[model samples]
Target chain A: MKLQRELQIVNRLGLHARACAKLVKTANQFESDIVLRQNEHQADAKSIMGLMMLAATQGTRLTVITSGADAEDAMTQVQHLINNRFEEDE
Target chain B: MLSLSGTGIGRGIAIGRAIVLDQGHNDIPCYRISATALSGEIERFNHAVDAVRADLKRVQRNLPTDAPPETSAFIDVHLLMLDDPVISQQPVQTIQEQQQNAEWALKSHADTLIDFFEDIADPYLRSKKNDVAQVVGRIMGELAHSPGKQPSDLATLGSSLAEQIIVARDLTPADTIMLRGRNMAAFVTSLGGPISHTAILARSLGLPAIVGLHDVIDTIHNNDLLIVDAATGTVLVAPDEPLLAQFRELQQQHLRHQQRLTLLKSEKAVTQDGEAITLLANIELPEDIEGLRSAGAAGVGLYRTEFLFMNRPKPPSEDEQYQAYCHVLRRVEGPVTIRTLDLGADKQVDGGRPDRETTATSALGLRAIRLCLSEPSLFKPQLRAILRAAVHGDAQIMIPMLSSLRELEQSLALVGEVCAELEREAVAFNPKVPLGGMIEVPAAAVSADLFARKLDFLSIGTNDLIQYTLAIDRVDDSVNYLYDPLHPSVLRLIRTVIRAGHEADIPVSMCGEMAGDPAFTRLLLGLGLRHFSMEPSQLLEIRQQVRQSTLAGLSGQVTDILNCVETGSLYDLVDQLNQTDSD
Candidate 1:
């Protein structure tokens, strides 16, 4: 299952590599497997290395894909994570 | 002696010999080590690790009690990486399997660790990789000890480079602390900004530093003497005598200005005719309260609540917020005005709802008061915390991004409700907590009279006011030129707000980037704004400017400038005012 979520890069320095990895890591915590696609490129949601290599800057559009029995829940969690910039404490 | 010019972040002049402190031999080499010779390398690596661990413990013991947590954490991570089985054992195994030298194995391992950290993406955690590399480098250097080369000797080498050293790359907190009090004349780095630890350390130490030099290393030779003017971010490479003489004069002038600033620290911010204008400081962190007290700030005009919201996963708890506020109140004898989080649509808090319609044009939308109303859960706790802390200090709560009377009423009702709940619980708090509103939006400014009647005071947040009034995002470099505070609209709005505040017999202040600037000090003073809150750095200059000008005279000149259509004339007027005492 694929869902579109709009996230603004609110961090003053923008969404650099580390922030992307965090999003991916948080997305991977759910049972469903996740894939994040930015613009035309897509990468594994579980692989922090793959997510950062995409270099999604702050204020970029990202689409998350989840597959498994809990795909909907995974998508919701990922969407919520992106909405909050993966939580400030992280 | 050669001099180079670059942006100056910190202030001070020093004459010293040139020293270059580079993160040497840390970069991973392409060549892989063969499987043979691995056991000896592993043994060497372990020995180095043990040595580094001991050194870290020593440093930790000696660290200052007030040192920033980041500094201590860096050393802690160094110890962790040294102890991590994944880091310690894997590299040794790889070196043995690949038959590679110690440097190759260390670099390869460091590369892997960097990759791991880079993938994590959190700034704090990502920065930790530097600590990892530093540890690994120490281990490698120990193993490859070119007879007589010691890790301790790096300090001596650093001191040697400190004299006339043009730091071409970013310096970590450790590097900065090590270089303190050395013959280090100035620091020029390829990375970092005014907020970086290195920059802050340089400021405290009175060292001249220029950051964001971008390839400044390639511009100068190893021994090429350079003069760094950190005040202007200019590095002079082999400067001629005339330029040197001019810089020396500028340095003297700066020193004189600093001395005058020091004198003003003890003096009241009274005008020539004996009008005492309260000079305050705007603080973002609780740590900054010390500087404010030292600077003799009458009070805190603005304590930005956004710092608590930013870069965190969850909103700071009510207890966390109270402690932070109470801490500031205890440190300063003056009233503290805490602005309820001024986060706009752009600054989204972690776990907070995102404003879907917000865009480049959405800065004015769903920010401050709007966000508070939309997310009452987030806003209520903060309101309760600020009010609770008010009993402990002269705390006043100021709402941000308020454009309507309705928003003010809603916020006031909420605060009233919180106060009642506290009363019912027998919680100690000042029931009559002075509530204020920021006149940042044009609507707020225009309706300042109404707000002044309802609110206790008004703080004009010029950064957002200018942005919203001009219809240009200050962050947008393309339209940055349009973000002029001197624009007719902004000035007119400011005049209106000041008038309204005065009419209601309520105090008004400008707590924005413009407030600290000496260039606009007289103009704001003339506009009937007696209260000024700015960064501590600008307090002295602004106070000095205030001392030199009479409110009546400055007001007349400002009115004249405001009425003039010549855009260039406004600057001319300011320039004239700046040079008035001199002439």
Candidate 2:
């Protein structure tokens, strides 16, 4: 199932590289397979290298997908992560 | 002579030779399996791995115990990379397939990997390219037949061309260490910042370094003589006689001034009229304690606890926090005022949520005391550790972002709870440790009299107060022009806080960015503030400023300035004082 959510880029200098990799890493922790697509570019949520390639700017919109037994919960938790810019600002 | 310009991160000068490092090839073949050569290739790869591991251990053993733990952890990662079968096995397989030497195969594979990272647009991600390059460089060196010897060309120019080294790009800390024994005068890189490891190391070693000097490599030719003025961030090429003579004089003057500062470090920080003032040091790291002792700081006024939590993956354990606090207390003979964790939405811990609710206008939101109250689990351990460490010396606990009396009451209750727990556990601790609050918010400053009555002491944090009073984000470069510490409103707030604290007969001190600045030293002193906590670097300079003025004159002039509607330059005020001193 695909989940769409709006998250503000709260960290200084926007949602650049390292923060995106962190988001992807968190998403991969669940049993569910995850994918994050931003501005029409999709990447495997398990690879730090792949998520870094997205170059998600601060305040940019993103779409996330999760598939597995706990996909619903994973999507709900991951939504909080994306909306919080992976919590890098805090 | 070749010259390059860059941002000056550290202040100092050096003259040495240039040693240019080539970006070695990156692609290593995955499999090297000629049936005849397979056995030999495998043997060679194993030996290379063992050699890299030994080299890492040697570096780790030589590192100072007091050095940042990150330095040792970096070496550990390298060791793990060497042991990774995926990395080691692929190169041997490549060598067998291509029928090439193991060294050549590894270099090719590493080059390919580096090029892939170089194509990325993000600068932070791009910075990782250097880390990758370092791993490959070490592996390739290990596989090479002549492991320690420099290439023939570099060997020829070794000690003879000792001048300034201008790199085409940023150099890693490993690269800086390689040039240790050489007479390398200065470093000019195409890119970096004041906070980069290269800059920090250069400052620590007292090397003249300039970063972000674009096109420096192409502009300067080999064997060009250059003069690097680290203070002003200037590089002079082929200078005339007069210019060289001027620099020589300036250099001598700087050295003499430094010596004079050293002599004053032990003297009392008293005004001309014999009024004494307390001078303390504000530090971020444990290593900075040495600087405080050297600068003759009476005590540490503000020990920023945020740094302990900032870079780590999670909050430091209670034992870890206790050890660090105890170490500082034992080292410094004077009072150590430790501010409990001031983290809010702006600073996120590992696995923590980003403070999305905080806005440009939300200076008071989810920060300091507010964050601590909401996150008691995170705040309690630190409080317990600070309270436990107080038994070692004069340790005082300061709570950040206290806007109301109720917040103080609740915070005090938590402290009492921790004290009760310690008593039950039979832990030895100080029962009479003083408690204080930071007056950084305008609301806190406005009601300082009420706050002073409740707390034992008050430290004015001018940085946040100025930011909130003027409604400007100091970090935002676009709006930084408005981040003034000398604004009329800011001065008034400082005055109000000082008056409130003094009226209550409680000790008051200023321990923020404004305290470190020389320009504001007199203004703060004139406002009846006798205690200052600032960076170790500024102690002597501020001490000198303190000794030149009488309290009466400072107070009178400050009163006149406050009454005037027209604003005047802060520099003009300092200059007027200087003129009077000379007359």
Candidate 3:
């Protein structure tokens, strides 16, 4: 199964280093091939370096694409992280 | 012998071997690594990363368990980032693919990451790039450091290097404090402003330090004989046999002079003609009162209360300020003239923000009394604090940078209002606390009699007075050549203020650099200035001159010297005046 969901970056600092690390660390937990697409730019969701290279900031909309088994679960977890602002009050 | 010039912090001389310390972030040397050497380079890189991790872990362990969560969390973030492939793995890949050395590869990736961060629109994100680079730089520093030679701090040095002069790129306060027990001969930094914590720490420690050398770290090697003459901010890398002998003799002479000063500390600052001079200390902080008992100071003439209000988030509460003033007053036996908040004019209370502009009208800006009067809420607490502390010990109020009687009157009104409130609340305070005004402005100095009649006493802060009067910023090295303490016009002003204060039946004290200087001790004594307030370090030496000179003897000559017009003749006469006391 494959799942694709578009989400807006709600964290005040957006996908900065700290947030990117948390996002990548969370995505690395699943067996799904996860990629985050911002505008025309795309990054492997499990790679901190790749996610940071995306340079996503607050109000930036990102498309999350996940494939293989548990792809739906991967999308859900990522959506949760983004919605919680990576659990960062900032 | 080799000579290097830098900004000197204190006046002292030292002779020692140089210990070139690789402090803070140092640029790493870069070179190519052969394919055959790639594995070894990788191993070296891994070793450095491990070393950095271990160092951080040690620091983490040293932190108290009850330490702020943010501090531990900060360390945790760095530790997690170390494990991140971006910092640890990317550099290794660069080393292998580029066939470059570990240090260079690490820096290259770090720079790329930092640059990526810089492109981020958010300022907060951009600032985090420094943290990433610094963590990477730590590994780079470890790899670049020569084997068996760790960066030196006073704590790390063995007794053998006790006489070694500290040569560093820069220092943190923690690094400086750990330098005790080394009998540190001297300190020379490649970077620091005069008011930087490093320079101020060196001054307080009474260490010979020359800062802002630009390249002292690279030029001077470890164990090279170093001759540091802080009086001139000159660092001679190595001296010839004859020059070495000369420096050794000068070292002894410096020691002897120090001993003489210490011996003179017990003596009263009384002139040969039986006229007594009040020698008081001009302190900036409570910490500066460490050795007031043996400093031969009657009391603190100027407790610059600005330190409490500066580098802080907001104006200190009345009680917070009261405790700080009380801390100093209760420690000292004599009266402490607390100068109410002299902030602004280089010292701003923006919670330690970087300065934006000095080109703006800095010296003439709304600072000191002007700033206080503009914000009564800010001014009221400080006044109340001084009043409250006066109940504990001999405390007096001194306002700074007053140009007119209106400023004085307004300040008095605030103090009066605070006292009334304290009375209404039945809070104990000395309502009779002697209120004085600092005469640093030309206008105030000229109108000394009017201010004298209204105030209890007057202190001539010649440092600012001279700076303002001659239109020369005293701290500006370029224009400071015009900052002559012995200028005829300056002396005439000093004489005028002292005479004005006397005629008005008030005592005038000088609490500037000129007051403590032995060169002007007799000259000021002759001018009929009664009280002398200077740095605690300078009080004894000034007292030594006071006990030796006859004020009655020098008054006649001082009058003629004051009347001299020619600059050359005036300098000659002033030099002669100093000679008479020495003779």
Candidate 3 stretches greater than 4 Å from native: A1-90, B6-11, B15-205, B209-225, B238-249, B351-361, B581-583
The CAPRI category of model 1 is incorrect
In model 3 chain B, where is the ten-residue run with the lowest total lDDT?
B351-360
Write candidate 2's Cα lDDT for B469-519 as tens digits: 988754343454576676778888899999998888999999876776566
What TM-score does the first chain of candidate 3 have? 0.96
lDDT by residue (A1-90, candidate 1, tens digit) is 545555455554344444554565566577777877777877676654455445565666777678887888887777776667656543
State the lDDT of candidate 3 residue by residue for B371-411, as single tens digits. 78987777888888889889899998999999999999998
Tell me the tens digit of each residue's lDDT in model 1 across B1-583: 4344444665665443344444653343223332443454567667777777887899999999899865765465455546655557776776677765556666777787678767755574455466566777787666644321111233445445445654546665445545645655677766654444456556544567876665554455334456677656777666677876877787788789687678889888887767888899887666667678677888899887876765556778889989988888877787899999766554555534444334343676767888888888888889889888888889999888889999999998898888888889898888887888998888888888999999999999887788889887543434644667788789999999999988999989888767876778878888888999987666776788778777657777888778879988877877886666531
Give chain B TM-scores in order.
0.65, 0.64, 0.73
Interface RMSD of each: 8.3, 6.0, 2.8
- Model 2 root-mean-square deviation: 20.1
Candidate 2 residue runs with Cα over 4 Å from true position: A1-90, B1-249, B345-348, B351-365, B568-570
True contacts kept of each: 0.00, 0.11, 0.24
Stretches of candidate 1 above 4 Å error? A1-90, B1-253, B344-362, B581-583
